[model samples]
Target: MSANTLRAECATPGTQHVETGHRVATRSAVLRYPSLTTTVPKEFVHRASVAEVMLTDWERREDHRFVVTAQWPRSHSFFTTANGCHDPLIAAETLRQAGSLLAHAEYGVPLGHHFLMWDLSLTVLPEHLSVGDAPAALDIDVVCSDIKTRRGSLAGFRYATVMRRAGHVVATGGASFTCVAPHVYQRLRAHRLSGAGAQLPLTAPTAPQDVGRVSPTDVVLSPIGQRDRWQLRVDTRHPVLFEHPVDHIPGMMLLEAARQATVATLGEGVTPLSVIAEFSRYAELDAPCVIEARRLPRTEHEEAVEVTGHQDGEQVVRSTVTAAASAG
Candidate 1:
């Protein structure tokens, strides 16, 4: 196997400007950057997006695998809450980019198009990674063994990312995404973007602790006076969450709701070891949405929790969260 090294600089808003020479490379083509922007085609992300581009460089090893480096600015809210450890979304975003890079760099897939996310999953072991005090930066390496695509539909691939501090593996998990044409994605987001958004009917915002988060500003779903359920609060005025405007509830927020619901299911705090989430349709902001988590039968390998979100009576999101069977 052959490997290439590409380096560049990162200049995100809160990044610690290190004088140490670090080359951030995205592709075979190398160029200097006046500012840090995403190498992934803008079209790949929704017009209004929340993906924080953490990995600034790539070193491709093969079509199925690559070793990438990401430096998380200590001040980045998207990657961390009260805790310093890198958030699950960080890994999610990393896996997302790996698929994008593989499709374009390895498979010759063009950019400036769109892809649909059919499913995504990850497993976290607390002992495997340090979440109490996350490092200022990370060394992320990803590998993909199975990738599939067709001429007129979505392209899909399964990938895993390993985070290392110094030279030891701290955390690892695998996930998958399916790509679709711009038209298909637009069609899926159409109803939510129709400018018919309605103010969500819900109670006052609850504390982040109510949802397993340590920060109050991080809470988006509040209790709805229902057992084991929460009302989705689309606070467009939030800074970190609504950094900009959005048409509907971000997929990540919904997933966070699931994470919180998992906490409710277990009563005790939980570090999700495995999660499988699927989206059936756009969860509209104007409509009322409820998220529910159901306890699952215990397995020899892990304890399971299942989550679902609904708009009115229609199901929008479904997820299964599992934690390691042994105590951490």
Candidate 2:
């Protein structure tokens, strides 16, 4: 149909597969699609660089179900892990891009619309995340639920995704978000829209090794002279975290802050395997944001921590990170 729209042809069970543009073949449980050779349009994922787009292709199975494909490089500039496992945040970003792509390509959302994330979570099997010699090919089965609409335009929805690598389950996660038109987003944001506000001065960051990060630039927490407490480090100049200009701190950045805080709280030799982050309000860049972590009751199997971000005396984000001793 249109360039921005996705066209899919479904095949019935026990029929010879036909390939044209996009084909969907029914398997026992998961649907299969043709091998994807290129990434989707960068705009669909709301990314400025094509190198940053993780979604390769998507095919709608039903009104609310879809199958998507993606490829992860053996090494990533920002998502690399010192523990020799693929960064779990890579799964988080892939899930995020899948939702954004589906909203624009399948659900008829305009490109200029804004999606506000309410919560995002991912749980991964660490064994399935090791970096191999070749790039990782992922098949994601996604189901959209709690669909909402207003004035014939998508308003919000919740989605759950199961990501698989080479027929083995790698990660499963879900998120909920609401879409707002450009004018409505402007009204809601008032003067603090993207690229309009100034950020607080960049503070000295904590040691990268203490946070499970190899690069100091990747550390998102600054020392506050208190145990389990630090100030949020917003480095807009960062190439990966701040890939694009924005008025306020991004939810992904806050998630990274939560991850680092958890790592710092739990000490060394631990790797975060599960992360759950909920956003109550935006963490403004102009004001200082405080990040605090408290160890949750530890279990025999895994240790968990609760991290909270506060800005201007208000709670902005609360995250729970569960980490186990890394085998590496």
In candidate 2, which residue ranges exceed 4 Å CA deviation?
A: 1-36, 194-197, 325-328
In candidate 2 the C-alpha lDDT for residue 319 amounts to 95
Error of 2 at 76 (Å): 0.6
lDDT per residue (tens digit) for residues 1-328 in model 1: 1113233354444333334458554432333344343334333333234345555456677656677665554455645633334555555555555566655555555664555555677655455445445533556778876677687433777777887656766557666666666677678777666776566654566666656776666676777778878877667676555655766676777777777788767754556766788888767778778888788888787877899999979999999988756563
What residue pairs clash in candidate 2, if any at all? Answer: none
| Runs in model 1 lying further than 4 Å from the true structure | 1-51, 81-85, 104-112, 131-137, 150-154, 187-189, 197-203, 239-246, 298-302, 324-328
Superposing all C-alpha atoms, what RMSD in Å does each candidate have to the true structure?
Answer: 8.1, 7.9
For candidate 2, lDDT tens digit of each residue in 1-328?
Answer: 1322433434445655455568654352345344327788899988989899898878888889998999998888999865677889999999999999888888889989988999999999999999888989999999999999999989989999999999999999999999999899899999786546666889999999899888899899999899999999999999878889876889999999999998898886677889999999878989899999999987778889999999999999999999984443
Backbone clashes in model 1, listed as residue pairs: 7-23, 7-24, 8-23, 8-24, 115-180, 116-180, 123-273, 124-273, 198-286
